[model samples]
Target: MTTEPCVAAPVRRGVAWHTPLSVAVLCAAVWLAHSHWPLLRGGAGRLAAADQGWLLLGATATLATWASAALAQQGAVPRRLPGARLVAAQFAASAANHVLPAGVGASAVNLRFLMRCGLPAARSASALAVKAAAAALVRVALIAVLAPACPGVVRLPGVSPTGAAVVAATAAGLVLLLCGPLRPRCRRALAAVGGDLRAVHARPGRAAALWGGSLAFAALHALVLVAVARSVELPLPPARVALLYVAASTAAALLPTPGGLGSLDAALVLALAAAGAPGATAASTVLGYRLLTVWLPLVPGLLVLGVLVRRRAL
Candidate 1:
């Protein structure tokens, strides 16, 4: 009885704290939108001048990403998931992704969904890691293949030997500093991920879905950017644009940003400029891309998330 009260008290307090925080965040968003309405209006006007067909194509690709994500999630585990619910969870996860840094929100939603589907917590986490690893590998592979076709599109900045050595030394020092405290936990996590990877790959069907879906997800994202560029009549070839998208995304992934918001926008703008887009054109292209991928689907995605929560599906 005493323990029950203690637990309930903390739960109540947590809810109390969260309610006010949520309201504060909502108010801040509204305030920012109102203050920045002119910028938003200008971006919208630019998008209005873009080719509608290409914009539609970008929107379609954005919608397809959620399905690809669900497929990859299923491929990470041997067990069959309820298909519709899985896709819905992915849609909800997208909205959640925009709220937390480094994909934490989406991962949490998927982890809970997997647990609801009966997997143990450790297994669920391992499956998520497998999916993430496959996505990273696919992104790198796409960049490698596409980058060569567009010569000089992505140039590595020349770094002096001294600078390189300093960076390497700093990385090594950081690793050594944390290694003692984190090594055991990291080892256990890696072992679990390795076990899951082996098991998932042993089944050819699962392996195909894992890699194929990851590829499709990355490709679709690139396609969204390409479509946006084309809509604005940007002079770059579609292939080159796709390559730039993949490369910029890969680099931006290093930053722990919410859905790669600021990091991705800046990287994409810089990449487009490097490819010869005028400043205004590059900014408009990015604005269009974000309109299709983030803002357009946000409200609906949040609704889906709420439904899933009410049904206890996540």
Candidate 2:
């Protein structure tokens, strides 16, 4: 009888916190949209003057990205997931992704969905790690293939001795920090991920789906940027734009910003400018890209998230 109150107390506390967290997430979304309204408004005006056909192409590519993501996610685990729900979860996860740094929100949403699908927690986490590793590998591969086609599009910045030392010191510090308290846990997690990775690769169909979906997701994103550039009539070649998009996105991953917001925007603008686009055109291309990828789908994505939660799908 005494344990009942103790258990009920935690449940009540969880309910209390969950309500506020939901409210906070909604409020943050509104605030973010409100803050970016001016930029979106101005970008809309610019897009209004641009080529609608290219913009439509960009939007279509944007829609295709979510499907690619769902495919990659399914390939991460061996279990069969409901196709429609998986796609819906990915769509909702994209919206949630913008609310937190370094893909936390999206990861959380997917993690929950995976758990609800009946996978053990450890396996589910390993699946996520596998998916991320596949995505990273695919991004690097794309960059390597595309970079050669667009000579001089990406130039290596020379790091001074002091800057190199600082970077090395920062990396060493992070390594030591992580190694201290989390070493054992990290080791166990890595082992689990390695096991899952091997199990996944043992099946040729799963391996193909994982790599193919990852490649498609990255390619589609690059295509969206290329289409946006075309819409704005940016002078850069399509190949060059695609190369710059992949390279810039890879570099921006180092920044822990929510959905690569500021980091990606800045990297892309600079990349386009370096590739010979006029400053105004470069900015316009980024704005249009963001409009299709982030802002336009945000509200609807959130609505889907709410429905998923209500239906207990996530």
Candidate 3:
């Protein structure tokens, strides 16, 4: 008989037992933390399923923004990068990011994936930085354009107008500062991102395409937020939703909780409540929106996490 490898089979059993058990424990923790919700009554029960159009819109907007971001990167990447490949990588990365603790885990995985695609580690870092900066800039631009439209976003519960202004300023300042002061290579990296209009000087059309993609992303994403808000008949107008979506999103990202989890849910619920929704109704409405927005994406993301780990891609 051929000699067998000495790995213990019990190790596999141990792992299997631990993984699910840990997941169950974490899930139980989440449930307990969010258990403060009052039991939904009649109107609240209806709110849970009412006017789901905004959820759909939000989903579509989210999908569109991610696709556009990937496509834009492909257009400006150094090598003749394949758009489909990057998009797939992005999807895998997103899934990983959503389920994994802390957001950087996904970025690390994405950076590793890119490195495997033949980029040097240092260069990959630069590319990630550039991509992040561009996205932030675009987000800030959108808020400025849209924020004026929804000046009353200040009215949302727990929302301080001054806090909103500071957030917007910080986003703009940080991104612009990074883009301007990087080394020559970093500057080239941004150009390779198509943010360098000079390289495409002979073809301004590419630059136009980049701006167009960004604009489309902003519009569609704002529409989705407005729709999600409407699903519950929150007192906030669609214009307010459109304009303040970026700011609210930035604040959501700042939360320490993984995936912003219960914190985001609470923020949305409170915002709706401030918009004149009953507290219980707001809770159910927010919960329903999460079922559509968070859970829908999260399930596939967990599966993708397996692929990332198995491939050692992170």
Candidate 4:
């Protein structure tokens, strides 16, 4: 029933701070959308004539992605969330994810939900962190497993200096997390996360749900991409297409774009091209993938988000 004190502080600010930040994020999303509009148009034109059955299948898989996310989120915590409401929260979380950078919006929503479900703020955050870490690990593992199966699917593109610098900075940050001087609360958070990890794994069902749901989430997303490619008559095999999705999505994660908008599109297009699809097919594939995954469901997702908020479920 109570919101986090930190969360309440910002809410009390009455959009004074939120307005500018929201506008900035919205502007960035718009710029990226505008730049990528041509591909969407081209993809739409092709999809207009695409196979409806496969497109429908892609849509089904996209829906499955939300379910998988819900399962994974539930697995992260010990307490049970009402199944129907939990899934709806995840649906709303997906919409929130598109509005904010990285996943701040989604995390805020889920954190509030977990707290309302009777967890303390620290445990709710730790649960979220554990779910995120498990999902990320599963994704990388899938990429490694699939990359070898499809020999040429991933390539060592020449790394630019900027990319190298980014990698170095990331490595430095990781090292700092391990050895840096920390405040008492920071140290406690690390302890809590570690404890949460062990606690989740100690329960067989939780462990299975955590890992299994994470795997399913990644697989469902890749399946959606594969089905979209098929709908547009792209010639790649499903396995190869799935490989490309995992790799592209993993790479896109580094960019921190909302819902992986621009970065994901670009990486996916490049990945498909590397997989030997024709230019139009590759473009159409990316376009169709985004359409099913992002555009088509955006409005409904937002509406669901609003309903959840009105109900105080998020």
Candidate 5:
């Protein structure tokens, strides 16, 4: 009797030099665009230098957002990554995300790190799914809550016809995809992509907690955006500041810019102006915010990348 030869299991892919290099080029392009955004908008010259309170508050809030996001990541996956370890992973992920193409390299870093932490590939994929869902839920809840509080948010030009429609459609589509026949198809698609998902459906309480955490995290980040605005002497309200921050941040994150680099700067300037802030102040505020959030992270990310590469951990 002739026996069929055993099939080979799929091997994990190696990191390629070209991949990182292309991502780096994208990052550089985005960073350059961000650096020049204020100048392009003719607002660079009018910016008031960031004051101490603004810087301090903004920095603190940004840290809080980062920490909370790290915790959310842990909660979603529960690969038993220690807080410190997870924090380091987050930093590495953020660094890679900023320096990678499509911002997807961060997911690779995360997958590798979790695997090293002893999670099965399937479980890790599930964790990523949960984290993504939780983040989306939180963002949606924010828009629902804030849209009412900030009346002008619903009134922006093209808000109702286009933005709102797209938002509603996207949210509905996600809901549909997560239910019934659509869900089965979605799961199959994910499975095709090497996602051996052991389904861990989100419980209501857990979902609430996750969304709550994300909301608080986003709010803190919004406060930082406000601080940056104030630092540039923008005459904008805190509510408007928060609303626009959420909207623009959502847009930038969805965009394919490296870590939303250039898009983020432009988004802030536009959102601030739409929310009634002066153009010059909005432009400068965006520049200052990018400096703290994006530019400040680059050096550490590079350091982490070097270390990770040397250790063969990436």
Candidate 6:
């Protein structure tokens, strides 16, 4: 008699845990959105019917952001993923990001999705890290390139010594933890990530997709903000607005808030105000941005997440 592999049992158990937990999380998210529906409606009331056309354009840009993310994710790994399913996964992941802090929800969904696609957890996680690192680098490059074009548009407050020390300590601790106790697995994962990164760079198609998608992702997000700014009649030029968005997003990245909820909103409003947008316009722009990117697609995104969970696609 042949004994079944030990991995099979745990894989099966994981499905059991994953499905219920995902469904529960989806339910909780929908319930939370429902409780906040009145606030969303109030925010929506701010937009004028005259600006509906630009708002629709913003919505289209938001949709494209998910597709760009999927493309970038696919490029991070050598393997080809089914396009439709991968895009769906990104959509679900975006929705998940709003509910969990610092993208934990989205990362969990994507990790599970990659596993279902036959990637081991280590490779999947490596792919994720690669994608994140690439995207972040591209974002910083964009800011560096654009900041000069719009001088005085982006103002960064000086970092306090305490904050600098805290960041340095955190990085040092992480380095120690990885090199000391977690060296073996960390080494393996880093090796796989390095190999994949090298392979992605060698192939023109994958390289273009990775870098292009990342650039497009940041640009599309900025476009959404620009569109919102226009809709609210914010006084800043498009270039200034984009730079302000990039600056605010970079600052907000330091905070682990879910979907950059409070932190991002505050940073954006402050940035816009600093860039010469009236206070009311800045606030409205933030509200409209959140409405399109977060509140509007939330319920449908949660539904897709639940369906994917039940189907074991995540």
lDDT of 4 by residue, 107-223 (tens): 987998777676778899999999999999998899889888888768878999999999999998977875666556688998999998888887888788889999999999999
Pitting candidate 2 against candidate 5, the one with the higher lDDT is 2
Q: lDDT by residue for model 1 over 137-196, one digit each (tens)?
A: 998898789878999987888999999999999999879876988888888999999999
Taken over the whole model, the C-alpha lDDT of each candidate is: 0.84, 0.85, 0.57, 0.81, 0.66, 0.85
Cα-based lDDT at residue 260, candidate 3: 60
Please give the distance, in angstroms, between residue 30's alpha carbon in candidate 5 and its true position after superposition: 15
RMSD of each: 6.0, 5.7, 9.8, 5.2, 8.0, 4.6
Off by over 4 Å in 2: 1-27, 174-181
Put down candidate 6 lDDT per residue, 188-289, tens digits, no spaces: 888988988998888888888898888899999999999998887888899888888887887887899998889999999988887777898899999999
- Alpha-carbon TM-score of each model against the true structure: 0.87, 0.90, 0.63, 0.83, 0.71, 0.90
Model 5: pairs clashing at backbone N, Cα or C within 3 Å: none
Over 4 Å off, model 6:
1-26, 159-179
Q: Model 4, stretches more than 4 Å misplaced?
A: 1-45, 157-178
Q: Which run of 10 residues does model 6 get worst, by summed lDDT? A: 1-10
- Compare candidates 1 and 3 on lDDT and give the better one: 1
Tens digits of per-residue lDDT for model 5, 237-311: 777788887887787887887788778778888778877878877877887676666566655665665555444
The digit string of per-residue lDDT tens for model 3 on 4-42 reads 221211223344444553465356434533552343243
